[model samples]
Target: MRIGELAGQAGTTTRALRYYEAHGLVRPRRAANGYRDYDEAELRVVREIRALLATGFALDEIRPFVACLRAGNPSGDVCPDSVSVLRRKLAEVEAYIERLEAVRGQLREQLGGAR
Candidate 1:
């Protein structure tokens, strides 16, 4: 397949695919005519990238998962590096939730006093 086909199959854009290439997430070979050539495996990698991005993972943060996938893992998160990233992200989300709860409490107090 080509860049456009990979983008369509991955539910992303050609621009994003290019960006991923630049960032070393997806590596497509160059055809003899200089066109980008992708395989089904690259399509699967793109899908993994998109799924992680939807969960608020930055491109850099996704590097470990990509490495895991490239290492032949059936699922990227099964690797130790990927697991570590997930743990870190979970902690960050927990901290964010705590702050949001504090803000909500303050807002509730303000509303009650206003009434």
Candidate 2:
């Protein structure tokens, strides 16, 4: 398929696809007329990248996942580097929850005092 077709199938724009290429994430071969010819496997890789991006993962953070996919892993369940990134993100989420709980407690106290 071509870049446009892959982009449509991957639910992203050609610009985003080009950006992914710029970052060395998606590598498509050049067609005879100099157009980018994408492989079917690229659909899987692009989907992975989009899914990770939707979850707040930066491009750098997504590299490991892409690497794992290129390494012939069909499922999106591998990648030790991604595991590490997720662990850190989980910790950050936990800390945010703790801070929110503290704020809730403060608000409760203020409400009680006002009452």
**Residue-level lDDT tens digits of model 2 in 10-86:** 99999999999999999999978999999988999999999989987899888888888888887554778768878
Q: What's model 1's TM-score?
A: 0.98
Q: Please, what are the lDDT tens digits per residue for candidate 1 over residues 3-115?
A: 99888889999999999999999999999999999998898799999999999999999999999999999988999999999999999999999999999999999999999
Residue-pair clashes per candidate, as listed? 0, 0
Whole-model lDDT, model 1: 0.95
For each candidate, C-alpha RMSD in Å? 0.6, 1.6
Which residue pairs in candidate 2 have backbone atoms (N, alpha carbon, C) closer than 3 angstroms, thus clashing?
none
**Global lDDT of each candidate:** 0.95, 0.89
Model 1 misplaced regions, further than 4 Å? none
